[model samples]
Target: MMVNDKSIVWILKIYLLIIFVFIFMPIITSVVFSFNSDRFPSLPLGHFTWNWYDKVYYDSETWDAIRTSIIVALSASVLATIIGFCTAYTDFRYSFRFKNAYLALALLPPTIPLIILALAMLAWFSKLGISGQIWALIIAHTVLGAPFAMAIIRLRLQQMDKDLESAAWNLGASEWATMRHVIIPFALPSIISALCLTMAVSFDEFAIAWFVSGLNKSVPVVILEILQGNVDPQINAIGSFVFATTMTLVVIAQLFLFTKKPNNH
Candidate 1:
């Protein structure tokens, strides 16, 4: 039995490694080709060159997309995190009818198909006369990102002691005061994690942005436009930059999540 278990463990490790490689190989290829002097990706990569990166740096359209993505990401992440915190705190501190239904709706956006969600957002924004605007993309991304923020913060809240808030109230602290001094402090790490995660989500999202962002394009939308034309080496460079950025944010979020210390309160 011990030998069998060891063999199984080894098999699982190999399987996991393969899965990671499969998922990341294309991204790795894109990064590698971004630095290759050759326009076409092939064996025996040409001499390393920074030309593609330089081109991406100077491309006005690319800069515009990057700036739009940054603005949308920042705005959406802040809005999403605020909404997520409120939803999570309500779930934690309140007991009301239809609570489960509320949670289901809160967490539903990510489960819906992106194309369907995009179409819905476009139509809704059009009705509101906000279609084809940067705000439209920002609003759409906020909706898409809020659920993720909620999930992360909710997990942190679940680990908190129920008596903590009660103890604060039993003292002289008002509801707002207790929340500010106790709950927010305890959940601060998770809040930061949620912000980073939601920003990453908004930064990488494409379909909805493409639908609602008629004139103001995000990075992913721009990538799609480039792809529609021809095989541009700039695509590889842009993809590499995006991959790096999202990965960095995700890594930071994970670190905060895992390294969060238990509140002494």
Candidate 2:
């Protein structure tokens, strides 16, 4: 028994170590390379400097792309979360024929080949005379983000106590009031989580963005263009900084919202 327990512990430790290293190795490598004094993104030994980050600061195209990316991500995330909430709430509260089919269709794009979806969107936008613009990208991203938001919020709603909302309705509250006061507050954490996740997905998304972004370049496209032209270490600097900043914000939000407080039970 003792030997088996020890063996299991060793396996678990090894598994965790492997996972951690696998996840962080690339990030560590990027950070190290970003500081290398060489203009080229390369390795072993070089004097470290902040010039790459400084270069990033002065790049107008990079800043423009960053601004564009933020706008697109925020718009897509908010729109998607709202639509998903409405869809999920309706599905949970009502019964109808083909309800499952509707959900399946909404979720199909995320699982399908990104290029195929992009092409379909491209065709649709061209038909609508709205091809190749930031609006197109926002539309595409919202469509993709909606499924995830729906899944997240639906899970939370499923676990929620329906009696709370029912009680409010029983006391002569309107449907809107019950939901606004009861359901929304109870589900706030999950809603925030879903919204944040959608934002992250839209912010970092590359393939679909590459397709639907049209003439207005987002950060990922701009980064790709810059790297393709020159083996610039500054690209590495920008990437490392973005990755670190994103992770930090995610961690802070999670801790702020999800941490359990003493005496809550």
Candidate 3:
């Protein structure tokens, strides 16, 4: 039997709605729990309260975890963005030996299952005597985050106007000058997107951080540590804050992308 176009459209809409609902269910629950006055996150809904959030704000340990997470995420994201931009720029602007091989290798890190990647990182860092070090977490996150940054920036670089840089060079601009004057401004949106994504990745990183963390913990690692003991609504509270900020940045990155799109019009 053949389906009508309207029927297909309705089915597709329903399917998408179902998918989105499933995707957001955990987030919705977490947000709800964050506001719950209950000691633990469970049903028999407790009185509505913002007490958990207040705790999250005032708790010194929470702040410490946040600080550690911010430091690692910022460091990793910046390193990733730099390396990603350089590799992407090279792939787009020049042809070199083993170019395809190198691109494949660049993409390889993200392809590894993160659990496996974390274990592999542990082994690698152990050989270098860096296991259980804070920098080890940063390095592992950089490895994962850079591939995503490279993927985003690479696509943006490909979509950029080829003539602009050439025009700058034709006008006697140095390569650095052309990059600064013509390319960087054009690629700014993609750069922002890459940085935001890497920041989120680094912030949420768990397996690698669990493996490589010394005395310090990323926010996710801290949460995991807390989970081992009594489960608290504060976990949900802090989680809500974490989710809000990271997702907000992701949304902003997406908006910036809309502004820098290739003029297909």
Best by lDDT: 1
Q: Which residue pairs in candidate 1 collide?
A: none
Descending-TM-score candidate ranking: 1, 3, 2
**Model 1 residue 35 lDDT?**
93
Q: Which 10 successive residues of model 3 have the least lDDT summed? A: 256-265
Q: Which 10-residue window of candidate 1 scores lowest in summed lDDT?
A: 256-265
If both were scored by TM-score, which would come out higher, candidate 1 or candidate 3? 1
* Per-residue lDDT over 1-265 for candidate 2, one digit per residue giving the tens place of the 0 to 100 score: 9999999999999999999999998888888988889766565558989988899999998898888888988999899989888877877777899998988886777898888988898889889877778899899889989998888777677876768878999999899998898777766766777778778778888888887777678888888998899888877887886787567646654653564331335
Local accuracy by lDDT, each model: 0.95, 0.81, 0.87
**C-alpha RMSD for every candidate:** 1.7, 2.4, 2.7
What is the lDDT, from 0 to 100, of the residue 256 in candidate 2?
33
lDDT of 3 by residue, 54-143 (tens): 878888888988998899899999999989999899998999899999999999997888899888888999999988777888888899
What does candidate 1's lDDT look like per residue over 1-265, in tens digits?
A: 9999999999999999999999999999999999999978898999999999999999999999999999999999999999999999999999999999999999999999999999999999999999999999999999999999999999999999999999999998999999999999999999999999999999999999999999999999999999999888899999999999999999989988987585566
Per-candidate TM-scores read: 0.96, 0.91, 0.92
What lDDT would candidate 2 get against the real structure?
0.81
lDDT-best of 2 and 3: 3
